[model samples]
Target: MSSSSSAMLHTSPLRRYALLASNPPASTSYSTRAMAIELATLPLPASADASKFADFGREVKGVNLGSLTEEQLKEIQELLYKHDVLLFRDADVTPEQQFALTKAFDPTSAVYGHGNNKTGKTTLSILHPDLKTIPRVPQVQLIGNGMVYNHEGLAEAKLKHPHHKTFHKTHISDEDEEKGATRFYRWHIDAALYDLSPPKVTTLYGLSVPRGGKQVCRYDDGTGDELEVPLGTTAFVSGRTMFEILPPELKSLAVRSKVRYAPHPYVWMAPAHAKSTGLGIENEGLEMSFDDLPPWEQSKVKTFPILWKNPVTGGLHFQVHPCGVSELIVDPLPADAKKTGNELYPDGAHIKDLGAVRDILYKMQRPAIAPNLVYPHDWHEKDMVLFHNRGVLHTVVGAFKEDQVRAFHQCNLAASDDPIGPSEEDIKKWA
Candidate 1:
């Protein structure tokens, strides 16, 4: 076994105990939902050696959309909440079938909508422009290297702006310049920049897997390097683990802190460059002063708790994403206060200190990248992985050649209005 793999195994026992202690089995009973056909959990393949965090995921071999029953649907829901991730090997599901599965999880999810297009009903298509949506089901967007190139267009579009042009030329590399254009490289919580609540769950069905060249990444601690055995893998970090590892003092502060996010138009815009630089559109960046933004744009600020309790698993998790957060205020007033701008920051208190707080959060997040906490899913055709957005942060691990057809269909469960803020009771218990 490789050193990284051995290190991961060494820490698995401790991490598993921590996870169990923090996330005790759910006491609430599930409804008597039954499946049409019994679905059985299958043993993982001997070669299947991903996911250092046991219980993070499970592989089930018994059912598909055609054979799905209400009971099986409920069981899948229960599994998703309990494990935070689920893997279905050889899941031969059609786009319509995928849509049906998403509906089973959350009927009102945004999986069926016109997305950004003004006219026809279109789901978000992350696949190559040529890959047409399934005849009647447009909700399933195909994803792969094409989506990555489309992201590059957005980055290049920013070059039209004088300030961005200078910054890119000075700080970004030819390689990074191309990659940064696509927001896929950035680690973030989904739908964080929008006014709407973020998604609760996300599902991905793999159609093609990259093979051959190894994907090498530096350790978060800058200790050395670790190789991603799978060429194109999807990496995930547990938000629960991130919260568990925080320094006691910082944990206390984080549980009480709130983060504010502004409107980020480029979140999923395809051909981003054209839309970003189009007439009447204004480019925005984190470095730009809040006061400089137009009143309407400035009004887009949305606040969320930094540390929140997951109602599903009854576990504490961090909801922070350094890239998406624009400001951090410790112990913010209730929403009724309607504070804005400078009023939001009293005495410029944590103004300069925000970076320090962010650095700590990043450090806490680093362990998730560690072999022990990280789960890099090696994709195989017909494989489907479902994960809870409320408990984990995920990103694409490696780059794929343009010719590689790494198609995937993604679906999301809409976030609930249930308060994310930790209660005094929660802080005492989880802290």
Candidate 2:
């Protein structure tokens, strides 16, 4: 980034975060709610009733990726876009094989959730864990204590961000809660920062999961655990509709407040120049502030961008996640707003009432329609589960935690923005 752009994005503490707290909604050809409903409520044909959720992929065969041509690889990318999620059943592939295969879909592949989610396919595969790197970010997210929001990815606040080079959680035996206790997430999305939606397909390979997995234990007696989600089955979540019912507090906050946080494509689209800069921030440094950007460049950023387009229809979807940096963290607000001429956000008194706002936002945790959809993949060896990242909010049940150790070599389907979000873009970069 230019010294100017860096300064422009620079948001030091003291600069109230409410400035960028909320970005206006994006203009999309398709309705986010409608798409959420369609995907979440799609009816399977009578044949589908007898057929398993992923029998389609099993029926359609593909040449072993190890034998595909570069052109064929590109074709597969397009194919993945079409199918959204595909499963590769019972094929002998190693983590290295999985990584290579995942990379085939996107050049920017990254292994995410270093320790929170299992990755190595088998007990032996655990030894072959993928590489880890500290995310360089300007903003810091600290929620309560165990729940911190940082670019290093989600973790219990007290835990040293598992990906941390030196920090590793002690895997306490179940009998010992205090000792081997690693943290658990309260069913949340991956990125909550910006308004950018996720991609169409994400694949998870179940290397191992507990036999008495938590995922499959939901009550069926009058309770709403309809889908008997199984391990090895790649489950999908609906990002936009997870909680379409915006809480009264949030609405009051939204309608009552004139001040708004514009979604910067930096969450998705950063300057092309940054990419060549070695994740950009590293060479130039993350201290780069948004104030450094020319007013004209600032004009180029999008408050909200349609992140997911239908692989087949090319339609857009809404994005809603508990993304941290992208949202205004009332406390420890960044200083970029005051230091600069409100490039990050316009000044407003609305922030004083954030606590009230939190109450309203808390209400959104429920569903206007469905709480959230989990399209479990039952991650068998060759199975691949894909879904629009923007379409849903997904979580790994970690059910395979039983004697059946489950995992596969994995990585974030990387993009070129955000030092910290959905990708290098959605993660932790600033405009």
Candidate 3:
């Protein structure tokens, strides 16, 4: 974080010693990294339809979303609201198209997300499976962003993966260290650190997801099933497609292993963070155990997980990533209540006992469902799809990584005629 930004944030009301002694609101807002981890399937919107567009998987390359006619643009926007995501394969896009796509979704969003220093417009990453961008600097590419995984300009506490790669944990990497072809970023939400509404829809056009069989996974909640939608398919998520209602079994399995018992120092950061941001985000989220929660807390746990609705269409979407959630304290149930456990997906995920808890667990799993409707297209290299930012969630099966030479571009801009960012009122309603 810049000294100026830090000064602004800290100097704000949350810093008073008394407020700091207890819990504060700014901590609720600014405490964690970019994305909240230890996740449950976040929910989708209310108006979901899976089969609206038969041309969804069609692929086309080398063009700008800017070229579409005014009528076509309106149709695309409406389609996005109806289907969540629109897929155009083999898309060849220009910087202008990149900017236009941003405008289509959230005109208020920056044309160049977080600039080169933070979010990569044509960014780069090096996973062994795919090569996505030119020169291996991936901000140059855009992929299925059901959930925004990029942070804002630059914030010290932006929530991100423990490591850019699967196995490493040093929070600080200076620019000199990351100047090479391999650029790594954690899975997180766009504009999550500050009080910014997450970009409703993010796009990732795969130049090549490769046939090597290294399938990167995305969490599909409805059936608690893993969906391997092909590269050509743009996973549109909106109302009714929320991940909040995950499968009963899958929700428990994600954290059931040793991950459940591990004690992380970051857990200690909660009191400090929560004390500052009355937003109530506990820094010690992962440490709380299902068995240790208080009665009211347990009830909240028993209730459905947090889900988001697009303020624009009143549509729902599943926006949770497995690694981005926290555990809530739960209270033990009465003996009789415990006897009536859930009877679905009775896999290893559910033990012999804890039946009631199991029921609550089941409720936490958002059903893995597709957009009520989608604009299906054939996979081709000359096309690009655009949609409403506050409309749906999007995802894909291929890694589309920079190593594979996969290329795509994106730029965010305000859609309003007056040209102002998304209003804070809308962000509150949407996020």
Candidate 4:
């Protein structure tokens, strides 16, 4: 027998078939046999259809981090990039496990401490006086209406700073301190005004969830109603979907423009006796002009693109925090212009129009409120949710009673440094 024929006769049936599949003989019948064998051996692709996953309040399932293998972890990572928000129902993960899962997705991200220094370790003892960090893990912030209260009732002893009053009063209703609405409720992405790059992923583990009356919300279609669900649910809007439906003119403007944000740390620096006020409403220090702010505060000004493209998913997202932005510069002139003394005007002067940028953002905000685009998560105890900050805008759904214990441990993944703008030409070409 020939050497090729001898080798084929000695090989296993599966191996022989696989080899033939790659190099089929001249006979059409052999080619057909090879194709059939090849098809039988190939692995199937994972499902990417969003509907197959859970929906709204309980979106996404089958995530058990405690028992996750390398392959399963990779699949979760892919789902996060694809779905933007994932609700791991009743995950019941411990602090260490949560930290490990976060590190897997972002190896370099440090557990974020609310008032930690630039390195995210050294504590700034003076900040967030009303909030307490978990002693075992300082990065986990204890947030809820009940944290400050005790058997003595609204334990004034725990509050040591003027801003503590602002924090304490925020969760209570103005009409009745005991039944007040949450003052911090506002649609926003975290840390937009800070000097560091904003966090890319945020995971919130619900340790305790309060069940109560329906939470009221206004819809984009000029309709308002109460959601027949538990209080303290976190509401989210898909920024990518919002950007996709924008008018072509606004879409182009967002890709080409940038927003200017200066430090407005009211949540971190509220005066000792200042009354708690809801975010997005008029509050102290929120209206100061850039020039009016102290030099140190003015130095916090950072410019960011209006439209940001996710590196992993290649998805385009509108990245404006309307409440956080101090100024909007549309079609801003280049920063490195060479001009004579008389020709050199201030950077603010070159802004095409002051309100123009905000007007365009408002257009985006309107569509974002539609029910189809928003997902309000009705959190269950031990439910861990991981969401991409680049693709979603989230806020507190409603107020929880002071007696209701609604605690959560929040961790953030490191921010991406890739320039934010329109999608890459290659990604666009494929689309």
Once fitted onto the true fold, the runs of candidate 4 whose alpha carbons sit more than 4 angstroms away are 1-60, 111-131, 148-184, 219-229, 264-300, 332-357, 414-419, 424-431
Question: Which lDDT tens digits does candidate 1 get at residues 255-350?
Answer: 657776644423333222211111111123233344433243545456787776776777777776565454566664444433334232222234
Name the candidate, 1 or 2, with the larger TM-score value: 1
TM-score of each model, paired residue for residue = 0.66, 0.43, 0.42, 0.65
Per-residue accuracy of model 4 over 61-117 as CA lDDT, tens digit each: 543455454555666667666667877766655554565566556554564523332
Model 4's alpha-carbon lDDT is 0.51
lDDT of 3 at 343: 27
The number of residue pairs in model 2 that clash at the backbone is 92
CA displacement after TM-score superposition, residue 347 of candidate 2 (Å)? 15
Runs off by more than 4 Å, candidate 3: 1-64, 89-92, 111-116, 120-193, 208-239, 243-307, 318-322, 325-366, 369-380, 387-403, 410-431
lDDT of 2 by residue, 1-431 (tens): 86634542564311111112111123212111211101222333232232223312221244443333344445556554444444444443433334445544444434332222332332222122222222321112111112223323433223111211111122224443222222112233333223322322344443333333323323112335234444333334443333223443332222222212223322222222111101111122232244543232434322332123334434323343322112222212233422333222233333424233333333343332121333444444444443434344454332222133333334334333332112223211221
- Sorted on TM-score, best first, the list reads 1, 4, 2, 3
TM-score, predicted candidate 2 vs. hidden true structure: 0.43
Candidate 3 residue lDDT tens string, 1-431: 96644553454222221122222223222222222111111122233332433322222222224344344444455555554545554444443334445444543444233333233221221121221122222233343222222222112111121122332222223342232211112222232211223354555444432333322122222233233333324344333333334453332222221111112212222222221101122233333443432222222221112334445355433333222233322222222222225423222332323233323323343233332332222244554555444434333223333233333343333222211222334223222
Backbone collisions counted per model:
5, 92, 135, 4
For model 3 the local lDDT of residue 277 reads 7
lDDT of each: 0.51, 0.31, 0.32, 0.51
